[model samples]
Target chain A: MKRTFPLIIAAVAGYVMVVAYFMPALQQVREDAEEWFNILAAIAMILGGASILGMHLRKVSDRRAGWGFSVVTLLGFLVTLYVGLFKVGVPPMPEYPDRAWTGEYIAQGSALWWSFEYIIYPITATMFALLAFYVASAAFRAFRAKNLEAMLLLGTAFVILLGRSYAGTLLTGWYAEEYPNLTLPGLTDMIMGVFNTAGQRAVMIGIALGIAATSLKILLGIDRSYLGSRNG
Target chain B: MKTETIILNSFLGLGVIALALWMIAWGQEGKFLGAQYVEVRDTIEVYDSRELAWFRTPDPDDPEETIGYWVERAALPDSEPPELADPEAGDVVVEPADLDRFTPARTWEIQRGVSRDRADEDGVVLSLSRTIGLWFAAICTLFVFSFLYRDNPFYKFAEALVVGVSAAYSMVVAYWTMVIPNLIGKLLPDLVQAAFVPEHDQPFYAPHIGVLILSILLLWRLSPVGGWVARWPLAFIIGTTAGFRLIAHLESDFAIQIQATILPLVVRDDGGFNFWMSVRHLVIMLGVMAGLTYFFFSIEHKGFVGKTARVGIWVLMITFGAGFAYTVMGRITLLTNRIEYLFDDWLWLIS
Candidate 1:
């Protein structure tokens, strides 16, 4: 019964969502279901937080390798959670000066806002920036004109890289007035708009068909993998 | 560490110290990196009443000719009065005193002359917290970038902090933006409106009770006992998402793409027989068809199919190359921005 109940719930929910597209009256049902899903998702985040805390706590308690890092993680998590949940340094709304909880959780000058601006933004941006060097090094090592396909790929990449930068304009500015289509930027635009779009569309269509078929299988109970192991 | 590594580290440290010293000297010469905020007192003119007197005028819809009558509000006392003209005869005379006879056309609260008076230098000082925040950000950025050289304690510390903080940040954001506003606000409208959202007037949705119950069940997953019950909510989520995506993808990706691919082989314009446009359309149609043919694995790839599929492979390669180039460009732009932040905002080395 443990697995059967969840399977029934899945089938019913899936069928209802599919059928709602045809019947306008069932639109409210679909919206309500979506709302329920959102609430569950939010609750799932809390579960995720708990899981992280539990895992870190276990590692710290066990005195595992890099336990100091785990301590740092716990401190960061708890401090951020405390400040955000309690709305520390967050002023009350202008209309509700007497109500402290009425203020925005991430209002300017709040501790949470400070953490986000100073810590989160810089770290994430720098992490992404570091990828630039890696991508360049990877391209240098991987790109080779061994075959017709490789040559085409390499040539297209070269054109795109140049066209996106100021150097392309400097190189092809003279030809732009006479033979615009032969210029780097013009070729780049053509490649992106025509060939790239065609390839993307074909891939997307295949993915759509695959998704539809899988969804149908789930709805009909032909696929019950989402319910997890039968032993449960 | 190797002797070479120690030497390199020493040189890097000395370079950073030198840059800092130069920045300090530059700041002493009247250029600084911190933000300066100003205080200003605003002067506003509030109207006594929302009611405004209006008059009938010729419609200004067409520039060359007046077609119909249009009702306009009375001009402010300081502004020029609008000229009332007859639509057909082109002229109508109305006395200034007669303007008051027109009925009030609109009710709107208007505030005018909202000017600001800037305060003195005392109000233009830098924020200590903001300066400190900038320094912290700069340090964190350096720490993250340190991973490029080699994994170190500083990078690990920054990584851990980011992971923990971001996870909690998302949770906090979701709680305030989604759960509290949508679920709690709906379930207990009066209480939420009184304490939180002053404008919230959502009627209690009975279905939200189900949502609350499901949320509780989902949260039960964190507990040691009866964690298996969370499967119900998880299954619902998976099922609903699958169903929604199925229709959405089919309509937007499959049907629409196929529809768009049905292009005219011959194109014409106002000048007639646009050759370039015709070639572009032909290429798009043939490209899409060939690309789709490559994905069709049911038929053996030989003869005509093989040639078309080969063309498809070339198209796909170009697509991937272009995509990679765009991604690299984006990442390089981000790197450039970070460098600018360091040199301009942190060190004050650049304008």
Candidate 2:
């Protein structure tokens, strides 16, 4: 009953949504259905939060490697939650000064806001910055010119690397005024604008067709793997 | 044990960091390598936040009236360092007769499209706390970068804390923004009051009891016995997204793209044949057709089909290489930003 019930809901919702896209009368149904999904998604946050908390708690209980980091994670989570939920250090909105708890949760000097600015902002920036080092490492080790295909890729990469930056202009810009076609930037633009778009479009078309087929399979209950098994 | 590989790696890593620090110092002096950057010293005016409140202007012909959202209440931010003021800006005289023709959404689209950085903020003095914030931010940045040397506790702690804080923050945002405003606000406006939405703006429609039931069923996954109930909402979400996206993908990815491929290969100017442009067009057409043919699995890739497939592979390779190079350049910019922040904002070494 549990399994069949969901399958019926899926097939109905799928057909309705598709119909609504073209049928004006069913547009309101589409709007209401989307709202339901949004509400469901918001509620699903609890499930995500539970998973994070559970994992960290288990790590602490087991005294796992870097258990201390798990403690930090839990502490950070609780601190953010407490400060935000209680509106700690946040001032009441200018118009609603008399209200007890109604205020901007991220008011300038608020603890939550400050934590976000100093800690989260910096960490996110730095984590992404780490990519620079990784790219360099990959270039040194993994990027090898072993064959015709590899050589062509390496040559294109070199041209793009030079062309996008100021150095390319310095090298090619002087001569580019006469023979613009042969210039680094010109070649780079052609490669990206024409060659890249063709490949990208081809891939996108294939992906779109694959998605259509998969969605159909799921709609028909032929793809029961998502429900854990064929029986489920 | 200390080995040659370890020593070499240590030297290389530390050398790169040292070079970065030097670049920052040099950048402070407005010189990198031999190149000198000119800094402009000028005054910049900050606009009042009230300007975006309504589509108002100082002209008798365009007197402001309190008309619904046609007169916007949402205030734009005060132009900061990043959001510079437009040097070319002047008091504009608007005609309400002209504005009345546009829908409020059209007016909004036109207004929002105006670039923020069109404004120039050259001479505004930096705040003390802003400078201090940059210094602290740099330290955190360095801590993360230290993972390049070797993994340690600082990087792990920072990573975990960022994850925890972001997850918690996102949860709060979702509850207040989505659940409260859309779902709870409509269902129990009397109970939630104006917390979910402004009292005046609350929906007049009947509470969607069906959605509420579905939402509760969605959360039933937390209950071990009622886990199956969650699948109903999951299936609905999946199916709806699929059904909706199919048409969207067909319109955008398939039909439109296919339409785009049907183009004239020959290029003609006002009088003569444009040989170069025609060649470019021909190459583009061939590339697209070849690439698409490569992905066509019905036919065996032999003879002429194989050669076309080979060309397609080369085209794909060029695409991937360009993509990789673009990413490398992007990563360089991020690193450059931190370095610039260190020199310009934190250190105050640059004017």
Candidate 3:
């Protein structure tokens, strides 16, 4: 009963979404279902938060390796959660001066906003920036002219990289007026527009078919891995 | 530690201290360490009366149809009220006392101009909190960059903080933006309207009650008991996602792509033959077919099919190379921005 009930729910929900596209009347029902799903998803985040807290708490309690880092994680989580949920140091909207809770959780000058601007933005941006070095190093090691395919890849990358930079313009800009297509930037555009589009379209079509088949399997109850182990 | 390592660490520490001193000195000299802004002249409009009324207006799309929405109009004694298209529908006069319960009185208008008045403040000042935020951001940025050298304590600390802070931040944003406004506001409108959104007049939606129940069931996963019940909502989510993605992908990726690829092999511009455009169209058509042929696993690649598939692979390689270059360029731009932030915002070494 435990597994069957969920399977029935999945079938109904999936069919509703599929059928709603053709029937205009069922569009509102589909939208309502989507909204309900979003609400449930948001609530599910609390489950995730609880799991993280439990794991970290266990790590700290057991005095495991890198427990100090877990402590730092807990502190960061608790402080942010408290400041944001409580709307700490956040002023009410100018229109709703009497209502304290009327203020935006991430309002300017608020603790939550401060945490996000200072901690989250910087760390996220720097993390992405660090990838530049790794990618460059990886390219240097991997890019070789030993074979035809490798040589083609390397040549294409070189053209694209040079075309995007000012140095490519400095070198090819003179010939652009006389022979536009032969220039690096012009060649880059052509390759991207023709070759890239063709490859991407083919890949997208394959993915779409895969998705359709998988969805059908799930709807038909052929795929029940999402329901987890039968023993559970 | 090696002597070289000790010397490098010493230099880094000294550099940090020196930068900190410079920042303090710069701040003391009235130089801000964050974003600069410009002031502009704003035009303000003053209205005499606060009395307002709700007037029924004709739907713009269909003149015969009238919408239920009542457009708010300030009942200015001097100016003439907008004439309603529907003469039968009289104006619903809202009392002055009830104006607060409805939309607030629109008394003033502010017109923003594009040009800035740079003569004011010279655009070099930041708020106290913003200034502190700059320093904090700089410190975090350094900590994250430290990972490039080696996996150190500083990098681990920053990584842990990000995981914790980002998760909690998203949850808080989702709660305020989605759950409270959509669910609570629709289910218990009175309480939400009274405490949070005073202008929230949306009628109670019965389906929101079901959403609330489902949300509670989903949260049940947190508890030790009845964890299996959470599968119901999870299943619903998965089903809806699959259903939505299937239709979306088929419509956009499969059908639309096929439709777009069906272009005329021959091209003409201004009633004359265009060579380049014709070549481009032919290449696109042939390339797409070749790429598809490469993906086809039903027949073994041999002879002409093998040759076409080889061309397809070359096209794919070029595509991947371009994509890689684009990504690397983007990441390099981000790295440049971080360096700019350090030099321009923190150290004040550049303008």
Candidate 4:
């Protein structure tokens, strides 16, 4: 009964939302669904933060190695939290400055803002920047010209890499103007525009199809891995 | 159930209804009511064009006022334009035509009274065929799914081909859509303008050229010669990105999120208590505390702190479950959306 009821609700709501697409009268169903999604996502964001915090806290409590790092993370987290909560350093909102709590938390000079500009921005950017090094190392490993096909892939990779840069233009700039039609930049354009676009479109099509089939299976109760092993 | 839970939920439910109503009303009005929109400065071309390098304006249907620049190609001169500008100052000219070019022209729209243009009848007719073609393609989808039955050569071949084709396509998109037009189109023109137009003789293309060199260095490091060439470029990218992110994190995480937490209990205009919002914040704040506490490795999990930290575990689990469920549902919705597009819009499946 538990499983059946939930499935029924899913089917009904799912079908309704689907039907709502064409039926102007049923548009509200789509809107309601979208609203629900937003609320749910917002809630999930909170949940994500909670989970991240929880994981680190447990590490610290367990006196795990790198617990010190966790402490730093927690301290930063709390300090940022405090600054934001009180809207520290925020000037009074022009309309409500006389009111004690009326200032914006993220006002330019606010402590929250200052911390964000000084602390959080650099750390995350630094982390993301790490991807470049990773990508470079990964490319070295992956882009080996072991065979004909690999060579072709390597050649394409080289073209794309150079094509994105001024070096490409400098090397192939002659073709851009002299042959204009046959320039390296032009070659890059063709490779990217025609060949690359076609390839991406095909994959996207496959991914879309796979997603469709997978969803149908789930909806029909064919696939239940997501819902855990039990029916209920 | 406690009446408090009911009352709180009711208040939250009302807010949801109100927000939904507002969005619908906004959409009906053809207005972007509460969404953030950013506009870039100019158009992009296959090759470089200095005059047309900036990102265009916010989409016409944006709900919120854009928070960006008002600089013009004219203001900056064809020779020199600011790399980035505010999102608000200028009218953002949206280029829907660019998006339209990617798809086969929609003749079905013409048939359905959604559009009346007859200029691309051939494209539309082709689009119609493609719609029906999707159903045929669905057959291949089954073959792809055959892996579930047993791992076979056929599935493997199909999967590899899909990956190969997708990789090829993505490489192209990254270059054409994101790279060539963005880098060359913007820089080339500026370079030309700077060289010829004496007043605007700014060194525009040199850095890009330098970056290009570094990118090559990056690639060359793979070769046996000057194996160290890769590190210089890597260092630049890493350093810049790290610096940019460091500044951004403070604003986004510390400032914005914190600001978001401190809210007015009562919304003045509606005279309604923002109970759900407050509860949401409080729960989030608690969750953050608990989660962070749980991660504190310096302490032992033997006492009151240990038990309190466990609350973080429960919060994390429930959150993950909900997120997974929502993601699954969203994927389903996207699939359903695409299916409906095929059945109804592409092929006249029913009537």
Candidate 5:
């Protein structure tokens, strides 16, 4: 039931949504189904939260090691939750001046808002920015021009990287004024416009086709490995 | 305690579920009534009715006529059963507006269009051209895919062609979206208008150009003599972007998300009761912190901190597994969708 039920639901809903696109009558039905799915996903978040808390509470009680960290985590979690949910120091909503709890939890200038603005934003950005360092390292390792094909790939990459910026234009800016056709930037632009787009479209089409074939296998009751070992 | 917890939470969970179902029903009420429709109606006072007479005299029995006709909210009827409608009928009986809903992009029409506005052009010309292009690209793909098959000249040609095409397309989009709109729109008018008013003529080069200049400086690292020139712009971008993003990321990710976890056991007047949700958040926050502690690679996790960190790893692993499972399901769904399209929409090889 676990395996078959999910597959049947997926197949039915998937097909319905697709048909809904080409039919006006089914539009609302399709949108409603999508919204319901989202709401269910949201509710699942509560379950996830409970599971996390339960697991940690067990570990802290057992004192397996580094129990201090669990204490800190639990404390931090509770404090943040309390601050946010209680709307700590958040002024009442202007519409409900008499009500103490009418204000939005993340109201501007509120403590929760301050915490978000100051504490959370920087950490995520720093993590994202770390990708640059990773990219640099990866490029150094992966971008070896061992063959003619590799050489061509390398050349194209260089042209695109340069063309995207002022460097390509500066080197060939004189060409823009003198002979626009022959300019490095213009040539680079043409290569990207004509070549890269065509290639991307083709790959996308193949991937789409492959995805279709894969999906058909699943829907037709042929490939059901995703459900794990036991069908029931 | 466990039984009591389950009993107490069961009712709460049921309440939440009921609320969710009601919200969904309310949101999609229009669909249920079969009254949600998009229709475009315009009365054209044609100088000669013969010019567009075909639309006016469209066959009443034709399904296409009803396609665009909207069923008004007040007049909406119950959905006729599929069995009554004869689901076995292969033909699509959609209301007309659905067919004309999606308009292809201007550039796409231009690029893929047959012979740039030929009056006597065959309808299949664009399709044929696309087919030919696809075949050539597919062959090139096979060659590119041949890298897996053991690299050869055919693959090389495809790879090079792909690179060339990609570069060209990016330039086209950049020109339309960024260069012409941002640069020319700002510079040309002000320059022309400046002839009359010198103060108004001040050319405002967008800060984007400055950023672009800095980006160019990054390329200087490739050359020996002028590589030093790249550092100034690099430093500016790094410093400014870091300064700008530092606070924004922290607020949204850490503070607000963490704040969201707190549960209020008692609802102060007018604060809608969210006791369960707050507790849930607190738990999630604990999980996140534990997970982070697990990744503290620099510190040895031997004693108190170490064991707790280990628990954190388990949390992370479970989270990862869940995320992976979710993604797999999504991919499967996408795959299913495409197959349905092929079978039902484009190719009617299968029922």
Candidate 6:
């Protein structure tokens, strides 16, 4: 019953959505479905929070490696949730001067606001900044010219590294002045705008066709693997 | 650690400390070892002579009462107030003072945003609080950046704090912005209306009923013996996404991409092939065919097909390498921004 019911739902939902896209009268159905999605998505976000907390709690309870970090995570999560939901440090809005706790949770000077501006923004920025260092190290480890393909990769990497920076400009600036086409930047741009775009386009076309076929399969109940084996 | 590694680490540490000290010195008097942004006065290319840069001119949308309106640095240093400043014959020399300019005219040496009143420095309310806040921010920023050296307690704490706070902030924003306003407020229209907030008149639509039933069905999965009930919601979600993605991808990723590849080999603007453009066009055409061929597993890659695939591999590598470099450049930009914030905003080191 579970298998058959979901398949029926899948077919109905899939066909309804496809039809909604094509037919003019059923346009509102798409919008309504999106609204339905939003409500479900909000609940899903809450579910995510629950899942993260649950995982961390279990880890802490188990006394696993990095369990102390898990404790920190839980403490951080709880404190933030408390401050945000309770509007701990929020002052009343100017319009409603006399009203207590009737202010935006993110009002300036509030604890949550302070935490966001000071604690959250900086850490996030720094975390993301690690990617620059990580990528550089990754390139060093990965780029070994062992074969013709590897050599080509390395050559391209060198062109890109130089061309995108002041070093490339310095090296090829004279050539650029005499012949714009011969310049490294010019070569890089041409390579990217033309060759890259073409390759990307081909890949995307293949992916799109694959998605359409998969969608068809699911709609026809030919891909019941998502639910489980039919025997189960 | 090896001596060489220790030496490098020491130098990095020294550089950071030196930079910090220089910032403190600059903040005190706006001159740290005579270092400043070499004021480059030049005209930048203008698109639409009337259009304004961000925070440059008064916003047309907002009323005059809004702050940051009258401030602009469009006028050249030598020129008298440029009314219809010709973009072709104008130079801008913007400095820190320019941004803090509150007056309609310069020669008014008054710093606008900055409170120059010496007495206010001692004022416990705004000054003390702001000072504490800036220090707190700087300390947190340092804690996060400590991860660059090695993961420690400070870094872990900072990471946890950021993750937790951001997650909560997002949830709070969603609840207030979406769920409460759309669902609860709409459903309890009269009560919400009485609370001086707008609510939809027609909330009990077919979609609403459908969503409720489905939501109930979804929640039913949470029950001990009813886990299978969740399959319906999962299937619905997957089906809808598949349908949506199919059409969206087909239109955008396939049709548009295919259409885009149909390009002219000649550079028409310069009235000829322009020498290298023809070569570029040829390379692109070949690359596309070869790349598609490489992905085509139906034919066994041998002889002619294998050669084409090899060329395609080169194209793919070039594409990936260029993409990686671009991403690296972007990440470096963000890192540069944080460094700038540390100096200019946090430490008050440089202008």
**TM-score, one value per model:** 0.84, 0.76, 0.85, 0.38, 0.37, 0.73
TM-score of chain A of each: 0.95, 0.90, 0.96, 0.84, 0.78, 0.83
Q: Where does candidate 5 stray beyond 4 Å?
A: A1-3, A58-76, A99-105, A181-184, A223-232, B1-351
In terms of DockQ, the best-performing candidate is 3
Q: Which runs in model 3 stand beyond 4 Å of their true positions? A: B24-126
Q: For candidate 5 chain B, which ten residues in a row score worst on lDDT? A: B31-40
lDDT of 1: 0.78
Question: Compared with the true structure, what per-residue lDDT tens digits does model 4 show for residues B297-316?
Answer: 57987688897677655444
> Native contacts recovered by candidate 6, as a share?
0.56
lDDT score, residue A29, model 1?
95
Q: For residues B24-80, could you state the per-residue lDDT of candidate 6 as single tens digits? A: 775687433322121112212222212222223222354342222122345434434
lDDT of 4 by residue, A24-88 (tens): 99776565444333322232333344454677689999999766656655665555555554555
Candidate 2 local lDDT, A1-232, one digit each (tens): 6778778888888888888989999889988877877777788887888888999999999999998999888888888878877777655433322232455567554667767877787788767767988998898797789987787778889999998887788889988979886799888888887788887777777777888888788788887655666433
lDDT of 1 at B65: 42
What's the CA RMSD for each of the models? 11.3, 11.6, 7.1, 33.3, 35.7, 13.7
lDDT (CA) per prediction:
0.78, 0.68, 0.79, 0.44, 0.43, 0.67
Those runs of model 1 whose alpha carbons end farther than 4 Å from true positions after fitting are: B26-122
Fill in the DockQ of model 6. 0.33
* Pairs that collide, model 2: B84-B119, B85-B119, B85-B120, B86-B119
**Residue pairs with backbone atoms closer than 3 Å in model 3 (clashes):** none
User: Model 3: per-residue lDDT, tens digit, B274-310?
Assistant: 8888888888888888888888888899999999998
Pick the winner on lDDT between candidates 4 and 5: 4
TM-score of chain A of 1: 0.95
Expressed as tens digits, the lDDT of each residue in A1-232 for candidate 3 is 6899999999999999999988999999999988888888888888888988999999999999999999989999999999988898676554544455776677656789889988998899999999999999999998888988888788888899998798788889999999998888988888888888888887888888889999999989999999999866
DockQ of each: 0.39, 0.37, 0.50, 0.01, 0.01, 0.33
Error of 6 at B73 (Å): 51
Which wins on lDDT, candidate 2 or candidate 3?
A: 3
Query: Of the pair 5 and 6, which is ahead by DockQ?
Result: 6
**Candidate with maximal lDDT:** 3
Candidate 5: Cα lDDT at B106: 14
Q: Give, for candidate 1 chain B, the lowest lDDT window spanning 10 residues.
A: B110-119
Q: Model 4 misses residue B85 by how many Å?
A: 41
Pairwise DockQ winner, candidates 4 and 6: 6
